[model samples]
Target: MKILDRYILTSFLKTFATVFVILFFIFILQGIWLFIAELAGKDLDAWLVVKFLLFYSPNIVPLVLPLSILLASIMTFGNFAENYEFAAMKSSGISLKRAMRSLTVFIFALSIVAFFFANNVIPRAHYKFINLRKNIVQRKPAMAIVQGQFNAIGNFNIKVDKKSGENGEKLEGVTIHKRLPGATNTTVIRSKTGLLRSSENDNLLQLELFDGYYYEEITTKKPAERKKVPFAKSSFSKQVMNIDLTMLNNNDMDKEQIAHTNTMLNLKELVYTIDSLESNYSKERQSITDNITNRINLTLSKPKIINPILDKKIVDTTEVANTLAERDSVPDKLLALFDTNEDKNRLLEIASNSLNSSKFVISSGQNQVREKIKSINSHWHSLYEKFVIGFACILMFFIGAPLGAIIRKGGLGLPIVFAILIFIIFHFINTFGKKLAQENGIPPFLGAWMSSFVLSPLAILLTYRATNDIGLINMDNVLLPLQKLAQKLFKAKSKEAK
Candidate 1:
């Protein structure tokens, strides 16, 4: 390597490594805050906590990569400017652009690393990190429980009877209260023997009862009731109930469960889900259409029937009027079979209500089905955002490197401050755009990449001006003209006064 090449490479590496370490520690500290919250008030071993942070490292690497690059470049070039190395190099016919060539190549390599980590390593590590957290949370009752306290596990309030390492678990005398919603009823269960066991699937606090009687009470708010309800009682032998104690006080699993979202899914899976939901929606729509058609056809194509009993009734009435209209001629059985006017009206009303209910059932089902399909369709957008926006890391470096050289100040001074402000704006816009896009106002791709698109050009413009030494805004030139004009006007006014 040439002396100049080595110089640029060394400068880039030293700055990048220093900034990367600082940012990486910040990431670890944030991860620890999250992990401690997950640990809750429960005691966990140091090794387990360390393992979680280690597993989380790859996911943090990609986000930190771009910022590290920005800071590193600014520092390297700023140092070069401050030391007059840049001026010396330019004097020897080595252009500013040529000196940066080595560092540019290094930045390109870092971009590739960012891409590889984001696409493959980070995703896999994210999955592993989630699974590891799940395992840790599900460890054992001892892991989830503090030594001396009342811990509410699932539907049961539990107190530890004894804890023995030799027995491989904690023994507890268990009391359970099961409350079902809507009714003022509660069942109380007591156990003489209980043990808390940690399994691969979940943390289990199992209860074994030699003999325990269950007591239950049901209450009602209604008054003026005629009868008293009977009380229920039950007794059991050797009852074993498994309780998930981990979820009693922790919300980590809830967040971890969201990894199943489509953002975690690859393109193929998202496509499959969308296709399946759309197909189901289509089928449901067709079914509703067919049902409506069938109902219409049934209503329109009714067959008419002649009534023999009505003809008989008319003949009988005519004969009765000829003989003695006032005489009672109808038999009870025949009269009972005849429909009264009120009865006829009621029958018509019932028929109308039945038809309306059938229509309503079909309409409600169609609406519910449509909503489900929409929900499924909305599920993939978040996954799309997380996976697609990751590509912006590489693009950010392109902009960062050029802008650093243009700014010509670094080392946590103006350049560093400028970079942070720019990144902050970029981050805010990206987040805001994502929220709007998720609600379907804008396209997902546009929202995710908007920041990079807007900032990259600004970087380029700055670089162009800096490279040609074309000043962006010459405050000296701008203010000097205004001052001279003011002086001339003031002198003219004085001459007129004289």
Candidate 2:
């Protein structure tokens, strides 16, 4: 290897390693901050905490690696340009492309490594990380209930406005919803103040309440009876309830029960899962369509009449049409359909209920379709993200190296500023595109590659300008337009004054 090539490679490697380690640590700290609600005051073992962070660290690599490469490339090449090394090379006839040859090869190799890491290592890590978090919640059930949020514990959903005391055992304004089996209504229990207590020997958490109320809406199998809105209510000065905590002590921490998440799947798994999901989604949609078709295109058959003289039933062909056309609409029209006003009212009531039920079914089906579309989009996004990481390395390097050469600035001053601004733009576009894709606003392919498509031209433009030894921005070209505009405005003001 030539001395110049070796020197450039070593310079970039040193800067890259430094920047990567620093950024990796910084991002890890941010992760800790994000999950502090689950981690803080949980009394987790030190080693368990370390393991959680270790499993989480791999997911941060995709975010850090590209930024590091961009910053490192800019710093290295900017220093070369600023320190006259590039000038010397140019004097001896070494062109910009020739200087970039070795670095480009290195980046290409790095991109491949990044692809494999994202495909294999990150998925496994994500699987483990999510399992670890779930197990933590199971082992320490108290930690699952963060302040001011509804949390499911045992058979009820519990929420508290405030939790005080050293161990957060004293609660104020506590509310609980206990749902009955196979029922839609919930029994509500509310308290002004509550106390939580437990012991190591017992597998139950006892909740003691003061100044509470118990309210439950009575439901019945008959819809007519249920419309009366019957309810049961009572007041209590104090009450004690025992919530079982045996499930929290389960020893299945190593079990991979949450493997169906999108992040846990690789290319092959994603393909299989997406196919299965689409098949199921298609069947569900067809079922809904058929139901709607049946409801909308319903036809009433002719009524049968009894003939006392012949002692046989006779079909009244005009019965349906005559009944329908008797009145303008609804209850009045049902007069010919039923002999009594009471029976006619009943028929009208049934029709109203059926129409309402159909409306509910259609609304529910629409929501289900939207949710499935989002799930499919998420899977596709995950599938493409693995490849995007690798391409990003090449993309960032091209932009950074050329930009550094064109600007002729080194160190952590202007280079750092440029790297940060460029990276922010890249990251923002990536997030926006992904969000749009997840919501089905755009195709997943376009959304996943949006940032790359937007920035790739900048890389090419920078490389071209640097190769031809053009300034970062031609000041004369920019200033000429502004100068002419200012002069024209000044002339206009002078004419107005005259």
Candidate 3:
């Protein structure tokens, strides 16, 4: 039994390792393609690119590890069943559960390691990956400028029709648009030929143009008085410009700012964040409620009634009569309210004020509500994700192992298909649930574990079928009824035809 356990364990681990490497490499290549725009044609150093990929590699581990586990489990168990090893073990009075015990223990240990990786290692890797990418994005203007496109360096937009020479230092048909500070007009420089170089310290870009024209538009103080806006143009045989690189040089963001992001926090940090956010939300809600209540009370307490009888009448009775005397004038009945309308005006003013205050309160309340929901969802998702990823690995192993045994097919052909289909379903459910949680449509725990809940029952069913030596889909039971029904229908049709 010990020898048998060792053999199965060894084979399983070997398959796991092989699948993990293959999948990881595939995903790494995919990442490169995904970020090709950012990485390619940037003239980045080879080592910098390699380091960026290395930092980003850990981000894929959580996604790929579970997938590899699924595939490897399926292949290992399918191969064993295909070779009749499981039958031999059963003949020796070893039950399926006993045969799986060693592998199950090993899987449990792997889950623990996976959890630690997700908690400890992945966060730091994420931080480094994000900052490195940001730094790469902030590479010097010379490195970022591409030919035949408008490239922004500081406040200037530069375009080169063609770039040549060994280091791309020679430029042709160069155009630069420089916007002056606090001015609407842009300084445009067009050159038929140019030479480009960066300072030794890369603090500035030196562009020297030949046989070019410079144009600037000056805005007049009064556009209506001027027939045309003033403008200046100069044809220059030689021109030089230096673009400051100070903004691009400061590429590094505050480390603390990056570290505080949700992706860069581990389980412990996530828990702390959730607690802090919950506390803050509680206080904010309390404050909002109190403020709203006080505002409402003040609005309600304001004296809104005015005595109309004591107010002076603006129009006399004779004037009202004169207005009534004119046929085209408004009738005295309609104009009567104008003679004593102070109270109505006061009431209208009070109502308008109350409405405005109410609108402000409602708007503030809605904003606070949304902010609270977002904070809570973010923290909760981060917290459950730590455990969910780890548990998913174990659950996937159970599913794949039994499924493979029941199917009794080995190698990549069927196993890979089944693994991918199952994983797709899992990934889709997990994503949908997370979105629901983020939107506050469901509890965070349920949303986080929704995938596991859905797959667990299927895993149990597969395990049961494998243990009983039954087909995965019970094809005989399913197809027998359909076959009988078809035969009966065909017999009835033939009789009718006869």
Candidate 4:
């Protein structure tokens, strides 16, 4: 390799490494802050927290890598352009494309590695990360109970108006609702103050209440005999309640079941899962159609007399006229169907029942179709995400490299600003497209590649401008119109003042 190629590659790789570490660390810290409530005051071991962060790091990599590449590329090329090294190389008959040859090759190789990492390593990391988080949450059930929220603890639903103290043991204005087994009544307890403590073995929680009222509603067996349901109420100075923590234990969850989620699958597994889901959806749709068709056919095939009074061509008009005359005007033909009140009631009941049954069938079919579509959309989105991440690395490099060269700025000042702005736009487009696809507004493939389609043209334009030694943007062209408009506005304001 030439000295210039080695120099550029080495500089780029170093910048990439530094930028990646900084960005990853920043994101990890942000994640910690977001989950501080869940992790802090849990009495968790230091190693466990570190392990959780380590497992979570892979999820952040896909986000960090692209941004790191953008920043690194910008800084690397921006340095060259600012130092006039690019001019020197250009004078020596080396084109911008030629100068980018080594870095381009390196980026391609990195992209391939990124693809494998995303497909193989990241999926396992996601599985482990999710399960570990669940286990941590289980281990610290008290942490799961947020202040000012209703929390379900076994058969009891507990809420607190305020929770304080170092371990969040002190509670004020507490309400507990306990469901009775095999009974319709609930036991409600309200406390002015309470203390929460865990057992030595951590298998149970003890709640001690102060100045509370206990109320229970009792239902009598003979509702017909009682004028009102009876209830029992009692005031207490202090009371202790025991809550079982077995359900919240980590052992309750099966690792295999949690690991089977779409986020935990590689490309091959995702494809297989998608295929299975689509197959099941197709079968369900076919079954639903067949059932609906059969039901409609059965309803159609039932022999029905088009003329209900076929046996009597000339109905007894005198009786019908008398019946209709009692109401108001006499309609002999319509009054013939209501020969008796019982007959009219039965006909109305049958019609109502048939209408309800038809509504139920239609509603059930629609719900099934919607659920199937959502499941299929999710699978397809996951499948496309695997390829998109790798491609994003290469795409971002093209954008950053040309942008840096055109702007002719280095360091964390201008380059960082430009990188962040462009990255934000890219991320927004990608997220918006995914949401649209998830809602079935667009095709999954198109949604997944939407960001690429939008940014590819910008990358090409930037590269072209950079190769021709054009400025990043024409400021004069933008400012001239705005200046003229402002002057006109100022003149109009002055005229109004005069």
Candidate 5:
């Protein structure tokens, strides 16, 4: 390798490493804040918390990697240009493109690595992160019953004075406060002892209480009876109740319900999932249509003449004659069939009921279809997102390297400012596109790649200007209009004075 390429690559790598670490740590802190619920007061050990963060950390790389490359490239090149190293290279007959050759190769390789990382490592990490969070409460429901403090599960607030057993399932001196429906009153229960039990495969967390008393405050509407506060008391020898662990751990813990979410699947898995979702969605839509069609067909095609099951032929013949066949008078004739007002009212009532029923069916079907579309769209976005991550690396590098040369400033000052503004735009566009795509506002392909498509031209323009050593913008062209406006105002002011 030439001294120039080696020097350039080394400089970029040093800056990239520094920028990456800082960004990565900052984003990881944000992730901790996001999952603070799963970490705090859950009685998780140090190793568990570390694993949680480790699993979550890979998800942050998508946010960190591109910004790091952008900032690092800008700072490295800005420093070179600011220090006149670029000028020395130009004087030595090396072009800007030639100088960027080594770093370009590096960024391209980094992009590919980013793609595979998203396809493989990040999905696995996300799967683990979700499972760890769910399993913390699911696999160990006993953790919810902390001793000496009130712990809330569903509607029951339980406080245990002491816990002693294998897995801390036994509780002594238990107090419970339960809230009744409608927030009308509160129920207080005291037990001398209790036990919490849960099986590995069970969805219910069981609480068995021994020697407990229940007390509830009651309310009455009558003025005379309002003076004395009514109350109810009950006692039981052994009370056992089951609390759904699925609710306690959150609905996401249900493996059957959560397996199809976009974050849990890799590329191949996503392809299969998306295909299945779309197929099912189509079938469901068709089924709904067919159901409505069959209902209409049955109602319209029913036999007008009644016959006994034992008889092969109808006893009486029914005939319908068209009183008014003209299209314009068809509505009047249809209304005329209900000759009396009472019959007309009954007919209207039946028609209203049918309308409402049809409306309900259509509305429900629409909502279900929209939900399916969103799920399908989410999977599609994830499918293309694996490639987007890789392309983003190259996109950011091109943008940053040329921009740094154009601006000709280094260190944490101007380069950082430009990097932040540009990165913010990139991130915002990416998020907006993905969100819009998820809602089926645009195609998934465009949404996933919108940010890259929007910024590619800017990268090309910057690289061109930097290669030619042109200023960031044409100062003369921009200033001429402003200068003319100022002169026109001055001339008008002079004429008014005259």
Candidate 6:
């Protein structure tokens, strides 16, 4: 490579490394916080936590790369500009465009890497991250148990005085507060010594305690009428109970209850699901429309029939008087027209029931149609997550490069703060888009990409103006308007006081 190329490449790489380290540390800290909160009490190896973070690094790296590149480009250019090296290069017969060519090439290569990482590597890592956590949660019961706190393991909220052994296979003193779901009272069990073991056949964590007492507390709330008795305790030499975690979670049956969302699905799988859901929704809507039309046509085609039951005679005078709202209103001529009012009432009731049944069927069909449409909508909305996240790299580069050039600071202080602010805004907008898309059926692609799409041109315009020395709005300009407004308000306030 030429001296110029080497110099530019060196600057870009150095800035990239610096920005990456800072971002990666931030991601690592977040990972640690999440794992501690979620996986701390679980019986998993410390190495597994390390592995989880490391495996997830690629996922985070792609997200950070675009911004990092943008920042790196800006810093590299800003440093050259500040030191007058850009002028020196220009004096030495190197163009401004030429100086950036090396960096641009570097960025292009990086963008490709970012795309692959985000599209393929990151999605796979998400699955690994999810599955690793699932395995840890399912296989390791000891890690799930907290020392002092009440840990609801399976159906038991257990606390241990001391835990020993490498795998937490032994407990010194164990107190279990068990409450099966749908049960009225909680069962308290104390064991002098206990052992936790997993079932070989399934993911069931079992507790075998020795020399323990089982006490049940039943609350009777009729204090005025009933006497209160304390809990009854029963001592046992040894007790064994096995609880199946899998049995408790019927949602994880691997059935098609809900769509596995976008981040959870690969590209092919996501596309297939979208297509299938769309087709199903279309079919359901058509079926519902056809059913409603057929039902209406059937109703219209039905011949009117004269009912013998409605024309039945009323034999008892007392029954006739009770059935009629007013004897004078019914008129003496029509009073003996019906033989039996019960028959007429029964026929009217049958007609009402049939009408209600038809209405119910139509309503149910409409509900199903709405649900199917929602399923299709949800599938599309899910796809937006991947779409937005995948393009964040390109967007970050746009903003980062310009901001870095504008700030003219290479180190972590101002540049980092600005980068974080930009990221925060971007993330907030992205999240908002997701919420709107999910809830309101806002155009999925438009909603998800709104931030990046809107911001890109602004970034480009800023970068172009910065590079070409064309003036655009800056922080000083933004503050100027606010400052003027504040001054006017202050003057008005002072004049009024005077």
Among the numbered candidates, top TM-score falls to 2
TM-score of 2: 0.84
Q: Rank the candidates by TM-score, best first.
A: 2, 4, 5, 3, 1, 6
Per-residue lDDT of 1-498 in model 6, one digit per residue for the tens? 899899878977887898778877888788777777566655446787776786667666745665676566667666777787876886898766576677667666666665556567776677667766565554555567756667766777889888788777788788998887898778989989998886444566778899989899767777753355556779998999877776443333122223255666666677898888878878877777777778656543433322324645535556555555454466565425556988667777877897897899888997787666555555665566555554676566656665555556666566667776777777677778766665546777766777887677877786687667554456787899999999999999999999
Worst 10 residues of 2 by lDDT: 299-308
Candidate 1 local lDDT, 1-498, one digit each (tens) = 799999889978988899899999998888878777466544557776676787788777755766777777777777787777777887999876788788777666666665545545565667768777765654444465444455544555555555456543645555667765565677777655555555445545565554667787746555543146434688787776766555633544324552544434445566776777767878887777767767656543432322334444444456545544333464555435537978767776877897897879787877867575545535545445454445455455555655665556667887678667776787787787776665656766666667777877776776676567564567888999999999999999999999
Question: Candidate 1, residue 316: CA error in Å?
Answer: 45
Name the 10 consecutive residues with the lowest summed lDDT in model 4. 299-308
Question: Of the pair 3 and 5, which is ahead by lDDT?
Answer: 5
* Poorly placed runs, candidate 6 (over 4 Å): 92-95, 142-241, 244-260, 287-391, 472-498
Q: Which number leads on lDDT? A: 2
Candidate 4 per-residue lDDT, tens place, 272-355, comes to 999998899899988887788776665435433233356345556675566556756646555365889888888889878978
Model 6 clash number: 14
Error at 343, model 3, angstroms: 11
Clashing pairs in 2: none
Summarize candidate 2's per-residue lDDT along 1-498 as a digit string, tens digits: 899899999999999999999999999999999988778867788988998899999999999999999999999999999999999999999999999999999999999999999989999999999988888776766656667988888888889999998888899999999986688777999999999887655788889999999999887888888998778999999999888889776647677778568999888999999999899899989888888868878434442433334536554657645654654365645468789889988988998998999999899999998999999999999999999999999999999999999888888999899999999999999999999999999999989999999999999999999999986798999999999999999999999999
TM-score for predicted model 4 compared with the true structure: 0.78
Clashes of each: 2, 0, 0, 0, 0, 14
lDDT (tens digit, per residue) of candidate 5 on 1-498: 888899999999999999999999999889888878667756667887888788889999999999999999999999999999999999999989999999999999999999899999998888877777766654456676778989777677889999998788899999989885579778898999999887656778788999988999888898677678788999999999787666645543324333546987888999999999999999999888877777555543546443344547645422322322333455645668777999988988998998898888878888999999999999999999999999999999999999988898999998889989999999999999999998999999999999999999999999999999886898999999999999999999999999
Q: Which stretches of candidate 3 lie over 4 Å from their true place?
A: 141-200, 205-243, 247-259, 289-361, 483-498
Determine which window of 10 residues in candidate 1 has minimal summed lDDT: 299-308
- Write down the worst ten-residue block by lDDT for model 6: 250-259
Query: Can you write out model 3's per-residue Cα lDDT over 1-498, one digit (the tens) per residue?
Result: 599899989999999999999999999999999988778766777888888888899999978988999999999999989999998999999977888899999989888998898889888888988887766756756866689999888889999999999878999999999996787887899999999988547688889999999899877788673558678999999988888888777665323234467788988888888888889888887777778878777543533222224535555666555654664565556435555578667767887898899889879887988778876897788778888888989999889999888888889999999999999999999999988998899998998899999999998998888888876887788899999999999999999999
